[model samples]
Target: MWKALRITTLLFVLLGVALSAWRNERNATDWIGPLVVAVYPINADGSELAERYLQALAVERFEPVSAFIAAQGMRWQLPRTVPVDFRLAPRVNALPPPLPRDGNVLSVINWSLRLRWWAWRHDTYAGHWKQVRLFLLYHDPARSPQLAHSTGLQKGLLGVVNLFASPDMNAQNNVVLAHELLHTVGATDKYDPSSGQPLHPDGYAEPAREPRYPQRYAEIMAGRVPVGPDEAEQAASLQQTVIGAKTAREIGWLR
Candidate 1:
């Protein structure tokens, strides 16, 4: 009976995730108003660096994100600005375990379950925000700088960004944040995961540039500027990035 119950529970969880994904996708594509995205900070390591990171946190820190989206919207000729209100939430003591690295159905389901539980537990603090939410997990680079990674779920309305907690890293951090934000709204990664290089046309901000070897800007979704066929670098800030046409279409900025 216990085994049967466990199987049933798992099935229900999977079903819920599937339904939520579908609903969120539809809503994201059809969204017509300001999309409020609340950012919650998590001090992954209880160190002085994390404390300093927290001290530097302010709502204005995310203004660049808003400006970036607005600029993209105008470039796309949208009727209205892509309104994104980002508010900072109180820091959390802990974060859920990392998602399974394996790309299997079961692993995907497990990760989904964990993500959903985390969101549900933290939804209270959101207090009727009724839009996308992002959780930024900051870690001290001095302690374990080598262990930072960021991720977002397509149509999941939540993202987790792991980055060093320092002012110097703020620009790089926002670039990651913008990429992940687009993911929640149905944008896909345009980079090669294995090599971490932007893919062809789809990933290039100026795919038709005279000399494609050294593109000027990085596509927001692609997350890197291609300096050579096999080499790329992170955009210093959102100023150096753009929402490519493909990404704009994916995120419902264009039809």
Candidate 2:
């Protein structure tokens, strides 16, 4: 009887987490109110440059992300003017769980569970449990020019973002942050992972252009603008990106 009771209790706990995750995702993409997001900054490399940048970090640096979502929401005629609000949380001293390097599904699932537990422990923001959490790891550009690919899990409504720590990189960093933020709300990437090139219609911001080869804007999820049939470049900032119809649909901004 005790063994059976333990199994039942474990099942109940899993069920509760699943239901809570479902509600969070629904509320976030419903377009009814502002989706609150908490960003936790961390020094990716124990470097003075990264630490200095984090010291001077301000919420204002993330305004462009909030503004970008609001402008796009207005364009989509969302019920609320502001679709999402990005709030900065206190800097985290400890790092999150290291992502598994292998592609084993079980390993990934285990990491996700551990990450969710870690997030629960470090959530410094005082809010109604509805806020999505994003942990940003800042690396000094001189030390680590390239960052690992970011991850966003809709299941837990959380994300891990990699970014460069520098004033000039704010715009670029915001672009990457926004992309991963949407991922936590069910937006899928429209780019080919192998080539890092934006896909055809769904990825192109203005797919109906007379000549699609040289597109002017990048679709937010696609990550790049198609400058040529086989060439694409990263968007410098949100200004050069747009929420395409498919992404809008995925995020529930469209029917």
Best by lDDT: 2
TM-score of each: 0.87, 0.94
Top-scoring candidate (TM-score):
2
Quote the positional error of residue 229 for candidate 1 in Å.
Answer: 1.2
User: For residues 1-255, what per-residue lDDT tens digits would candidate 2 score against the true structure?
Assistant: 999999999999989988877887888888677888899999999899899999999888889999998888888787787788778889888889989999699999999999999998988776554568999999989988888879988888899999998988998998999999999999999999899899989999998998787999999999899999899999999999999999999999899
Residue-by-residue lDDT tens digits, candidate 1, 1-255: 999999999999999989876876677667576777888888888888888888779989889999998888899986768568787887777786687787799997888778868776865354665567788878887787675567777646878887779888888888988898888888999999999899999999999998788899999988999999999998999999999999999888889
The weakest ten consecutive residues by lDDT in model 2 span 123-132
**Local distance difference test values of all predictions, in order:** 0.83, 0.90
lDDT of 2: 0.90
Report residue 231 deviation for candidate 1 (angstroms): 1.5
RMSD of each: 3.7, 1.6
